[model samples]
Target: MEITTLASTWPAALTDPSGRRQLKPRTKGRTMVIDKGIGLHAFTDLLATSGEYIDIIKFGFGTSPLYPLPVLKNKIELAANQGITVIPGGTLLEAAVRLDMVPGFFRQVLALGFTGVEVSDGTINLSRGLRNDLIKDAKSLGLTVFTEYGKKLFGSRIDVDDFANTAEQDWSCGAELVTVEARESGKGVGLFDERGDCRDDDLSHIRSVIPNLSRVLWEAPLKEQQVSLIKTLGPDVHLGNIPVHDVITLESMRRGLRSDTFELQQVPFLEYMI
Candidate 1:
């Protein structure tokens, strides 16, 4: 499928500060936004303004079932048409797993026009075998599968060995990416400290064990966290759980348009040679 990027209308004098924020269909530097009950009009407005910068739109948590059927369907359809993948929050799948409704989950997902599924165990105990099956099942139905690591509980931290093992297994099972959970609040969870700051030691540990960083998506909902990850990992790191309104802001930071990363690129020449 041909992904259409917004025209690069600006002059060549302005280069991305990081020097390599590729346009979609991009395999790296992906941003996944979270939709917390946004209406149809607002959803459409967001897509119209910044859809190209977004890779996925997750209907946050269990809120996916709360939307009117038509609104939900339209939102998924719009995202798919714009080349953006759409999936229900991982918590929804957890609910299905708990209730033994995995089949229904996939059926409803496809019936609703969602292009992806997030198989997560943040709130439930999913055996590794089950997790693998879920990933494969989603792939068999032609959905892009995104499995997640980390628990949703407060103060939960990632286990490097377990995470590395699970990530490899998930990939072998055909999952596209593995998201590290940060919940909606990015504090005291996963790689974040109590104050929403990143735990660099933990991040480095994870990186050391994982062979490929490109397959992992860190959920950084806060601007500071996003900036920190972009600076530490370069702009190609895949990030998730971004709020809808912050799409352009995150993209700006990715391209070094913001002060936090303005030094990422060489200084622009003051003398224009027209």
Candidate 2:
């Protein structure tokens, strides 16, 4: 059967088991993939197979500067054509801020065709004024701004009050989303513990304070972290830092097609099994 027809033939009970949105330009359930230097062919393959499931693509760290100008622009243009927001990693932004090159950075990003910017202080300290300015600057340029909370330091944990305050400020400054930092390792930072376990209490507290959970994106690079966040926050929760190869796998878990979330299906079993 053709791929489009296969879903139609599935048991009615199995269709849309999780009732989550499946189309692109989705407001919630966003997935942000981290590109840690994949080649153009690999990148093209990723977009070909899984672009529909992606909402954003982050060029990990300062590597965006290292890519040949033409290659970087091509990648950004490809993602834009797929309706995916492309951004340089926050670390690069932090570097720009430190070097007093924020203006040049934004110009380069826009000229290169990136559609968004990640304003984060993961590796360095950014004053509230500076952070807000960065968000505003990006917004003034008609760029999507995604602000990140939490530090990248090992064993860094979330302070609920601080997070709440920062998130509010970020939104007021025109940030479209606020991401909680879990780094690429998905361990010992923000919501994850040293062993990469999701800190349930912290996550719960964050959800309680943040009225619109859809505006919050949790960086969950590990499979276990993804599973835990989805199970706790439901499938529509925004997750980021996903590896390229795992895009389909993550979408499967979100839609209840995978065993981890199979029970998320609304219908009871066996009746449709035969």
- Which candidate wins on lDDT? 2
Give the CA lDDT, 0 to 100, for residue 196 in model 1.
Answer: 99
Q: Which segments of model 2 are wrong by more than 4 Å?
A: 1-15, 268-274
- Model 1, position 130: C-alpha lDDT score: 89
Each prediction's whole-model lDDT (CA): 0.91, 0.92
What's the residue-level lDDT of 219 in candidate 2? 97
Q: Mind giving the per-residue lDDT tens digits that candidate 2 earns over 1-274?
A: 5455444377644657777666889998999999999999999999999999999999998999999999999999999999999999999999999999998999999899999999999889998998888999899999999999999999999999999999999999999999999999999999999999998988778878876787999999999999998998889999999999999999889989899988777765455655
The superposed Cα distance between candidate 1 and the true structure at residue 260, in angstroms, equals 0.3
How many Å off is the CA of 202 in candidate 1?
Answer: 0.5
How displaced is residue 164 in candidate 1, in Å? 0.6
lDDT of 1 at 25: 80
Give TM-scores for every candidate, taking all chains together and pairing residue i with residue i.
0.93, 0.93
Predicted structure 1, TM vs. truth: 0.93
